[model samples]
Target: MNSETTYLTDLAAVLWPCGGLLGPGDRGMRRRVRRDRGNQYLPVPSAHNPRVILPAYNRSAATRGITSFAQGHSLRERARTLLLTGAFATGMAPLLLRDRLYVGAGPGIEHALTAALDRDLSIAIHVGPPRANRKPVLLLLTPGGRTIGYAKVAVNDLTSRLVRAETRALRHLAGTPLRDVTVPRLLYEGEWNGHPLLVQEALPVGEQTDRPTRRQLLRCVTQITAVAGVRELRLSTSPYRHSLEERIVALGARPEAAPLRAALRRLPDVRVPFGAWHGDLTRWNIASTARRAFVWDWERLCLDAPAGFDALHYDLNECVQAGVHPGVHQWLDSGSRLLRDPLMSGTGLRPHTVSTVMALYLIDLATRYLHDRQAESGGRLAAVDDWLLPALEGLQERAAHEAAGPA
Candidate 1:
């Protein structure tokens, strides 16, 4: 079976241990037993539809599921949401859909969810491409189609760590006052079948298709950075730098990490402002409404990092999503622009500090990729050496050339 199919099978076993998957026309079982025990789901569009597993015969649930799943910032993703919405609105969803999964026996996730929320709840599962961070993201919906919360279930070690980290990050930021950005409120966190589960309040993501403006983005970043307050520390002596070194050493001479170590060694130990960053601040992870930007995916949130890191990350990722591969030049440009922003003045980021922070960011990112085995896990950034290391090495070369004095 393909990886997706395997994942589905494994997930089914976890969610419904006593349940058996049945085809659409399986008729050997007692009608009452099937009615009371099984939950029917139609794999929308096709059997292998990787987008959503819609609860059968529930238009409201399907619509919410489609809207939530297709909230990507990419044009292709937006087109998909439109297509699926159109298909369901025209009453053609059932006709075009196939390969229904009749999970024989409930009292699994549903039981736990109902007990936790103190109400009956149904779920629409979002299935995306397989990757290092891939996990079951269930949209908890009421029988009447209201989305109550979004639950993430960690099926492996990496995801387990992420699930716990997100929970802690949410709790940490709860006490901080934020005006420009809103984060998910931690609704519940518990364990099921030995796997960590985190449920957070659903953002009022209804019909929001806008992106955050530059001013708004800067405001949000500034607020998050101020959460932990800022500190000025040299790269060589900062706790952040020490943590990175420990991580690199843990990798222990892995060929993929050699360049990362070299880059770290070459970076000047200039003192710069360090603060918190919303680690994965990207267009897709945020929803912009008129009032504020709603950002999610907080597993990577770090309390100590160079100021303006989030803005720099957002710019580079935006380029990558737009089909422009960022290199050393892009890094330098972004870092420089961030230093010029008046909002960053409090963070003490200066023009001379750009290259140091730039190198630090690259090293930080490279070590993460290697440590997470992102490439091995089928992540889009599979070849860190091809894209990331080249940038780091190039920046090293540039720094060397600049230091040696005008040719």
Candidate 2:
């Protein structure tokens, strides 16, 4: 048996006691290994017993299948194919290859990575303080310590595609004005394992009070507008698509169906300039050391979107958190009013439109919270249930109140 086959067989033997097989059926654990020449499908021997003689399969057919699927495709597609074909196993691979997958600069600091500096460096892994998808990020930390960030893909099936798109988008931004706009610096990028890895410098954590201020938020909105005015920002692979709409649809087929469809149809009619708006712009993404507002998480940076979408997204999150706090409501109100004034002046986004969108968004957020009850019970869902959802509800109510007109 070849070394690759031997390695898989050994893994099967070790894991057989705990669980018979990794995935469905007893066709032996399969893995896809990509090399310079081509892709190879390596079948693992079953640990049941050596007495059972199964038919010998042609390795070439499997290799050809993998090669045909991977060649000329983006890294995202390649990764997806690898995972779906059972070539790339999750959780286990990271644990088994922990030594190769991670590098610890010091105690309490571990970064999942893969590198070849002279050639290309790519850091692929998911990151967060703990849980919280709001701040959950997939970062590519480069050689110079520069980092580019992307949003996490929700669907396991499309994870590969999402990663590749994020990588491509980041590389495009690296060459644009948004290159060094905010967050950590970025270096090289490529597919690693089944996810995209970007090598970048890590940013230092600062005091809580150092977060972005009101003026900084205004400035960010203005900067985004200026960028959009020059060129149309690309929103999605499919034209006129809104991620929010997708979320709403996913929440429940019936409760959100009509409204979401209507909102999507109306989205294109709205004349908001779209250019690199942060899809999820909350305080966490914006770090402040009491001097500058450093914005991160560029994966959701779409080219074309509503002018004040980021600002609204940010303020709404704050409102949800501290809506009941003294002056918090007034703060969100004033911020919303201001955001709609100066740069987004001509954009005619009505009160009803904002209210409807906010409501739909909140509902979607709540549904996600419900779906993750198990993870939450494990103490990972604290932020979402305790803070995010409440804050979002507040924003929705506030929007509805405003839409109702003068009291």
Candidate 3:
């Protein structure tokens, strides 16, 4: 590729500021435009505004994979594989070892972690605000507060289940075909405070402005979702389908959740392709650098889900938080155009497939909110049932009409 040729990542720089506050730490991707020179390229200088350096993202050569390129993205892939289990785990290197000194006491936790990891620098532990359904995050930092990694623990039965699941998911992905795909590399997993603990390398993401539109983001996510297809086989029936159905029933039992429940019963049969999906593919869980989107938060990973659900989750996350209020129906209709047109163009799903996927996505969102472990924080989904259900039902009607297109 010529230095003058425009890379999709270069185009992405144009959209960074537009995707405001869309990722972890509520940080957005912002970039400065470079002047195109004939057959040549030069880095945009930071001699003017210093803030540009703070969100500084460097894009590598372009590729189809979302976060890292398989062909030339060896920087992240060459990470030293660490042993975290079985007999090989004990007395490991600093970055690979779990803190052996802190049994449970709070005072020595930082000391134990510092000694177990990096002894030379002074360290501080900061407990982050609780994430929905996950433990309060723990940030490990230098005395200057540069982050090393984030730590999570099985704080209770609920968190334990989630933490353990993510550990398994990362390990399951370690040696797989999509090994080069950008994902958090697990640093260590050991017990602390009578529960399981996991520490992972932190990867930051921010987007280039126009290179990845809301449309391109959807395409990028859908591209990565294909990893699940490569990683696992689609089952004739997934236990998760039953699990989601059961949640629908549980929520329906609550009189207030009746609309959400009723909507679930009307979904068209969807085609669920199997593979690992990030589970939570929202702006909050993904970051953008120049070349790829870094996806984190793997606890909800499911091996079986219809193709479009991850993209569906990403699109709906911010909306659900603001409540299922007015204009949501119109917004969903307008937003879904991508799925109907460019997203599924090459896949050959029938027109009815659109309606089914749409209905299922809404039902899945509602299910998540009704049970949102956030304890008083999850459901703006309750409001979604008001207009979105009817809106989804309309998809079915429209799909039927389109299937019988103008005589």
Q: What is every candidate's alpha-carbon RMSD to the true fold?
A: 3.0, 15.2, 17.1
Judged by lDDT against the true structure, how good is candidate 1?
0.77
lDDT of 3: 0.47
lDDT tens digits, residue span 1-407, model 3: 33211221222222221211211111111111212110111111111111011111111110011122111123433232111111122322222222111111123334445655764222222222233453434455554435567667555577788899989887866655342246788887877646777878767542342123465566565656666553222222555567667777776465436765555554444444433457777665665544565667788877656666666666665554455554465446644665666664443334445555666666676666556644343334444446555776676665445535532
How accurate locally, in lDDT, is each candidate? 0.77, 0.41, 0.47
Q: Which candidate achieves the best lDDT against the true structure?
A: 1
Error of 3 at 82 (Å): 37
User: What local lDDT does model 2 show for residue 133?
Assistant: 34
Clashing pairs in 1: none
TM-score to native of every candidate shown: 0.91, 0.47, 0.61
Candidate 2 vs 3: which has more TM-score:
3
Which portions of model 2 miss their true places by more than 4 Å? Answer: 1-114, 118-155, 158-162, 178-180, 203-209, 228-254, 262-271, 288-292, 322-335, 341-407
| Ranked candidates (lDDT, high to low) | 1, 3, 2
The superposed Cα distance between candidate 2 and the true structure at residue 302, in angstroms, equals: 1.3
Candidate 2, 149-223: lDDT as tens digits: 322322232334444555655565556563224554555455332344444445554334345666666666666
